[model samples]
Target chain A: MEGLQTVGSALLTLGLVAVAVVLSLYERLDLEREIGVAVVRSFVQLAAIGYVINFIFGLENLGAVALLLGGMVLFAAWTSARRAGDVPRAFAVAAVAVGVAAVATLGLLLALRVVPATARYLIPLGGMVIGNSMNAASLTLTRIRDDLAEQRPKVEAALALGATSRQAVAPILRVSLQSALIPLIDATKTTGIIFLPGAMVGMIIAGADPLEAVRLQIVVLYMLLGSVSIAAILVGTLSYRSFFTPRHQLRKGVSG
Target chain B: MASLKIEVRGLGYGVCGTEILNGVDARVPDGEITAVVGPSGAGKSTLLRAINRLIEPSSGEVYLEGVPTGSLDPLELRRRVGMVFQIPALFGTSVEEAVLYGARLSGGDADPGRLLEVVGLDPSLAGRDPQTLSVGQQQRVSIARALALEPEALLLDEPTSALDEAARRKIEELVRDLNDRLGLTMVFVSHDLSQVERVADRLVLLADGKSVGEWERGDFFSEAGERARRFIAGRL
Candidate 1:
């Protein structure tokens, strides 16, 4: 009955969508259809997930919760792997990176009782951690792969000088990691002053206390930072090996 | 007359079925400069890399000092057989750092000052930034870097193609001088027949990824070497 009332109230927010559509119509911004589609898709997706999450919260079994979270991590890994072009075995790299980061961060949160051991808290928070880690994993993989190609002469120069593949790429790994982490770093830096995060705002909209919302949002930010760092480091460490042979020679066709 | 310092035996390297070095063979005599000369796309550079195992050969083995290089640890092999590429690809920003890079990799040290002198650069240049120097000086720094490994043999892949003619002559002199003074086995690659004649004790003429003819410098320039004549005539 409460969920039904919330959905009824949310339907009144169509006027908010119409405001953007009206601006697009007047200025011919070419975004009216995209806005409409995004709103519809997000509404449908969130509404479906809401009912599913409601049902999971009722059952409250640990195994079932773990299975759902594992599915999210797998999809995140697969999506990130595809985003990284031309890297061989990137799927396994992404899976290990994103999966480990999520497990470590979420496991710690649950173990510390900072968040309750329930599907309601776990599913939404897991989405935030997995989604951010996935972005970091893909960004690091793609940047490292491309940077290796761009820095081929430097890398090959190091290799020819008898430096191991690890030593040769260690410099590049630093730069790629910085590239992956910069976005999360900036968002964390400006979180409260610039804008309230979506999770915090959602909590407030659901009638939770603002201070309580801030507490969860801070945890979300720190979790993101830690997970993104782990994912970036792991993806970089794993992907650089693909560029070299076991003899430490830069493999052919890796540049492309 | 000296024992062969490096022997490349029927080496073949291909990429995606396009053969880059096909059954190439060359013998680099000890303490002498052997120039691999070829036209563009002749796999001269590829042949040089095959010796260092920078580009692993598909069908053959390279022997260093009578030992099959494949049987040795590759990092140790590379340290002993250093290579200098065409672009003077210096790694670190500081000249001293670049010169000492190989040394550091082997957990050893070489005097960057002495190395700079060996490659015809002032020791003071070591303190300067390599990127700020002229291309010739930078190439010399790269050569110094290779020498810092204390390699038994040095492979130079067109070490002066990116330099002007004067710089090229200076590098040629430095290479010849290194051979004379250090007794380091020197194998250099170039398409310029004139450079090869000026620098090499012996020559390997490559065409279409194969060693078509190998000759002492005396025979290569003389009239009796008919295959050399054909290559010079662009008839091969």
Candidate 2:
């Protein structure tokens, strides 16, 4: 009966998804198949990850934990790299930016003993940091490419008048960094008032103390803010070079 | 004999198997206005860019005053050879800021008021906002901005094409005056042959991405210059 309660509740959430599918059908949205597929995929993926995470939790080895964290970073980088179309060495750039950002934030967290050195705490927090930073790095790379291409004439005018590549692109870099960080900035600003964040909601559902859940959610939000900014700044600094020649000429057709 | 200030020797550029400038050659005389006249896709702008190392030529070298441009730092070369585009791409907000941009970048200094006067704009125009000015006025501002760098040569890429007839004539007069009074070496790209005759000391014809013929202004449209005649008639 105890285990059945947990299983029963999980199965009940399917009813919420069923309602969404029903609404899609009523509206003639033609999205019922997509909704069903997405729900099934999410269920299978989460179930697989749940089993894998539980097994790692039992082992309690740091190496296994580190390996899982590395895999998560690689997957996050790959996912973000897709958005960085036509950025030279985009995968490498995204990986380095996301990897460094994740490590820096996660290392500081562990060193400070903010989160316990267990799979339960580390995996979720690390995932949050990596996921947020991936979005940022991806945005920065895309903006840099698009803006540079769009502003080629102004850039070349500056270059033609003895301006360095750095001087010419400083404006674009500023805008890209601002764009990459704004989403996270807004999320941070509206955290508690606008919406209760997912981490805290998950903790509450798992029956953790409400106050404990709030405290953990605050730490998660702070980590995202820090790591996302780091990744964005890093991507901007690294990717601007790809748009110019060594002689400071704006490369031909840099935008995707 | 007039010395050649800018020399394009077999200049070529191609990308992804399409040739833009195919071993083009031209010689721009010092302290004179050399007008490059051609139809669309003639590579006139590309050749002008190569002279200042703005666009590196793939197959040949460009020399400025007999010094191989490849030997100079690109920034120094660009400073010595100013460029004004077809559109008046004025950055920042006001006219004065646009005028001083090159000077600021190169650590040189020029009075905005005087540069405006040099470009035939009123001194007070410097204080006005760039958006408030006409397209012709904006082009003058961009030209003045280039002049602030004290460049040895100026590349004008169809500078008057966007202007009305009155403004076009004014800019044409300005180009002629600049060469006559200041001895400024200018390579101007133009579509109108009459404008070329009004301002140019020499005419360089470009077609099929190469220089097909060249002549002094008097002979360009003269009866003896059959090649030039055929070119004007769209036969060459």
Candidate 3:
């Protein structure tokens, strides 16, 4: 009877929190209609995630875990490419690159005992790294595309003057990739001094020692930095060819 | 005949079966300012684009100095033939950067001061952002950029169409001066007949994707075909 009461109380509390979130979003974005849609989507997604995570924890199979991680990477890549706009097969490429890079880096850290190999440690940490890298890749690709469109005349003139496609877009490509890495660099530089990052705070709430939490957070930070940098550079370089042809002319209908 | 700088023979371009330039045949003489004049949708710009392979020719061939342009590498072809657009298109944070972009890409060294001077711009404008310049000034900076490669032929598509009369005269004078000083082969495209007369040594009049008439600049005004005359009078 007491356990049932405790569960009932927890349900009430969760319902209230959901209401509060909806009300807050409504107030902040002036989006009354969006609140209901957002709440429903969040509920469905979170519930689905709960089931999947529970299954993974129960099975604890390496292949299953790898498949789940791969799916996340593919989704991240698809979302990033969608955001970047009109890249020919770029989303698939970005997905494979970000997924492989993020998962491999985080997996190595786990194997090296830098972070715990438990599902709790591995899943969230891998997700965070992959998510951040996806953002970096998306931003880099978008900026490069926009810069190429805006600076087309200069690019054409360059081509006319004996420049290959890579040479033609070198200036904008350099600037775009550098700008994409700035946020990750800044976050790393200011990690502890500026704020207590989510991982450290979460660890503390879960009753870990403060020093231990801080050490793990540092590892996560460095891992993210490495993963995102590599993803941004690779995605930027590979995606550039999609914008032009083998003959170095801008591919018609590719530009948004 | 003196070597033709550019020869477009029966060129046509289409996208998804929609033709843009149809059967365009024209010869641009060496060291002559040949103006391609036509109204909107007459394929004036498309003709210029075909010459440098900016727009692929679906049916015909373009020869640059007797070598087929389609045979040469596009980058190498572009290096010898340069294009300046209708609107002054400048990129980068500063004028010098935008102008030098072409030279840097081509692996050539161009004196920014000399290039700016040739375009009738003050050397001090070099350090300033091109976005801050007026329309005419930006166009001059674009001219400087195109000239950076010392291209054998320059293609201008309504280069002064976006400027005021005062700016127009300045650009016109600059074009004339560039032609005389450098003996550059120029293919100038314009909708304005008077501007064509002022600049062109020879004229190729286009209408509905076809070359309607060809004549020397003076003769084009006097002995032009009825369709060409009507086009000039804005009657059709």
- Candidate 3, overall lDDT? 0.82
Clashes of each: 0, 0, 2
Question: Cα deviation of B151 in candidate 1 (Å)?
Answer: 0.4
Model 3 — TM-score against the truth? 0.87
The numbered model that scores best in DockQ is: 2
State the lDDT of candidate 2 residue by residue for B6-38, as single tens digits: 988888887667788998889899998998888
TM-score of 2: 0.93
The per-model DockQ list reads 0.76, 0.77, 0.53
Error of 2 at A65 (Å): 2.0
> Which CAPRI level is candidate 2?
medium
Model 1: per-residue Cα lDDT over B1-236, one tens digit each: 79999998989999989999989989998998999888889998888888888878899889998899888888999999999988877767789998999899879999999888888888988778789999999999989999898899999988998999899899999999999899989888887777888999998888888888888999988877766767655832
Candidate 1 ranges with C-alpha deviation above 4 Å: A1-44, B230-236
Select the stronger candidate by TM-score from 2 and 3. Answer: 2
Worst 10 residues of 3 chain B by lDDT: B223-232
Share of reference contacts kept by candidate 3: 0.57
